[model samples]
Target: MNLFPDAVEELRLRTREFIRTTVIPNEPAPGERLNPAVRTELRAAAKAAGVFAPHVAKEFGGQGLDIAHWSPVFQEAGYSIIGAVALNCMAPDEGNMHMLELIATPAQVERYLRPLAAGEVRSCFGMTEPHPGAGSDPDALRTTARKVAGGWMIDGEKRFISGAAGAGFCIVMARNDAEDDHLAGATMLLVDMDNPGVRIGREIHAIDRAIDGGHPHVHFEGCFVPDDAVLGKPGEGFRYAQARLAPARLTHCMRWLGLARRAHDIALDRTERRELFGSPMRELGIAQNMLAESVIDIETSDAIITKTAALLAIGERAGSSLSSVAKVHVSDAVFRVIDRSIQLCGGDGVTDRLPLAGYLNEVRPFRIYDGANETHKWAIARRASSNRRREVEQGEPYRADVDAPR
Candidate 1:
């Protein structure tokens, strides 16, 4: 992660310019996903701008940025809703790409990671499922993969699968029937979307529409894949998931923080032009307070993203719990920034004319996405309690798992 200081800064500035000049103009009306034609055009523009796939390895046609370096560049990409897509760093795809690079074999890298990082195809992560299945608690995952002679037979259904509809493939997580328990029995597999037994159900119309490949319901009935389809190992799905989520959640925070900044910028502009009772609206006490609070929110969010990113760069899974901390705080902070922006902008903010409402719609789910804030709070408290108990028993400062690779 010790990239040249100058290069990272230059990339960040270029990304900011690229987002403003290229992606935002072409951004579809608020609450709508980009059409294929527009997406293709923006990606080309991103490639020309030298900002595409900044997180992927350079050997794979990307800039080869590590976790720490990704913070500034990714936040810049977040400035516009379409910015991440243009740069080929959007979710499911970006997160899946990270996971692929971590465990994909040379051949798998060529078949999947290469095409995905190059923007030649799209992919989805199949973990979240319908109620009673895996959601906030992944241990409850119901998708099962039964052992077969040459491979596996995967079954069960998945809901809220981002990029499921038009994705080229799915990185699926399924419980190995032989494991007999919910804990360590799950496995990760790469499932081609065109497999005969794979069934894509109706799309789930969620609040965030800017996201491509609208979240859809998916089913796998006896879907079979050969031995090589297993991602890392038969029973280490949760570890790989932790490996994927720690950084993925932070990247989400980075991108949304940029969107929150966008909302704040929009509000600040309104304040300048607005006048009330023959006095400048910007001079009002509450107005000034809102602006100052948003500044605080933005700065603090950036600080947390930086802290978590640094922990992840040196030790891949080191930030697991800290990422939960980042997720809960960043998500809530960004939402408040957006909400305050809406309040500052007055009536126009709620209308489609301004993107504040759309920003709210997109960010509101973030509190629940990547695991709910309450769930994260519970996990944080449990970890703290466990750490305290160990600290007392050992009669030493129990630094906990933050430095250890989870």
Candidate 2:
């Protein structure tokens, strides 16, 4: 658990201790999510402990850890649902800060990323829409933005927009068909949530209650923002999305892995104590196998996460494809580990008596979000096929042995 690099080892340990002592003590009752008020308090404590916003730059009031270094730190913070938010690293805020840091103009940075990194505000990334719209396929985005006299008019309805209810702003993805503009195609626009045209609808009330702001319906009707509101270049929304999502996916894996470890630990404690037929249950063969299998799952998930993190740290051109691999594998692995943990806990697992049920609900959506696992699998398969196609066309001899030409 402590194989982190020297630079991050102390911070990671501090983060774990912080979560165990500070964040876990403040966990809300079962089935209740953390509200802004509670989150504000935790953020203050995290700041005092120098553990808030580890991913943002120091100039932005963060600890300035890069993507590779974030693995253990984020994992520690994710041991409890409250921990990530307390450290100001929960989505969509965490992902928003990352995107803003990468793409925001100076004026935009001053207006958005500064307070966001300081934990003064929260934001949402509005990419997914209602059915028949974007969802897992962002290319199917339904939002539209048209050039106006001074700026642009945004008109669209985004559903299942995480943190939309109380977000200070939103990074909206809208298509611009006008080829005459400075740039066309899909565009990223930063829209203030308080804009006259922004409206928040019903809270989705999803099964998971751990996200700081519950996902909700966000409608943008005639919302207008100056041309200065554009994030990065026009026609580069998808590019910026990849910039945000690729690393965001890895971080999600990191956090969920921590939760999965917690679940495993809970099961381990129970098995060691439970007596069946006047003997310790954990000593039985089947129960022992379940524990061993979960350990395998957790360790493998960690290895892939570490590898993908390294690829990300170097800004590897293959990072996105590798991220897809990590996302699909880690997501499934975490779910398997947690499901087994719950089974090991027996009756107590399904009830609020243990956090296993909530953990299950939280991780179940991961497969569907950040691009569904099925979508990632299809993409990964295509990439492999493309590589093989190139090899075959190049007249390279095929081999059946592992790591050979075949």
Candidate number of the best lDDT: 1
Residue pairs clashing in model 1 are: none
Give one digit per residue, the lDDT tens place, for model 1 in 93-194.
999999999899999999999999999999999999999999999999999988778998999999989888889999999998955454357899999999
Candidate 1 lDDT: 0.90
TM for every model, in the order presented, reads: 0.95, 0.96
**Cα shift from native, residue 144, model 1 (Å):** 0.5
Q: Which number leads on TM-score?
A: 2
Q: Return model 2's CA RMSD, one decimal.
A: 2.3
Instruction: Estimate the TM-score for candidate 1.
Output: 0.95
- Candidate 2 Cα misplacement greater than 4 A, ranges: 1-3, 179-182, 400-406
Residue-pair clashes per prediction, in order, are: 0, 1
* lDDT of residue 198 for candidate 2: 94
* Overall lDDT per candidate, in order of appearance: 0.90, 0.88
Clashing pairs in 2: 399-406
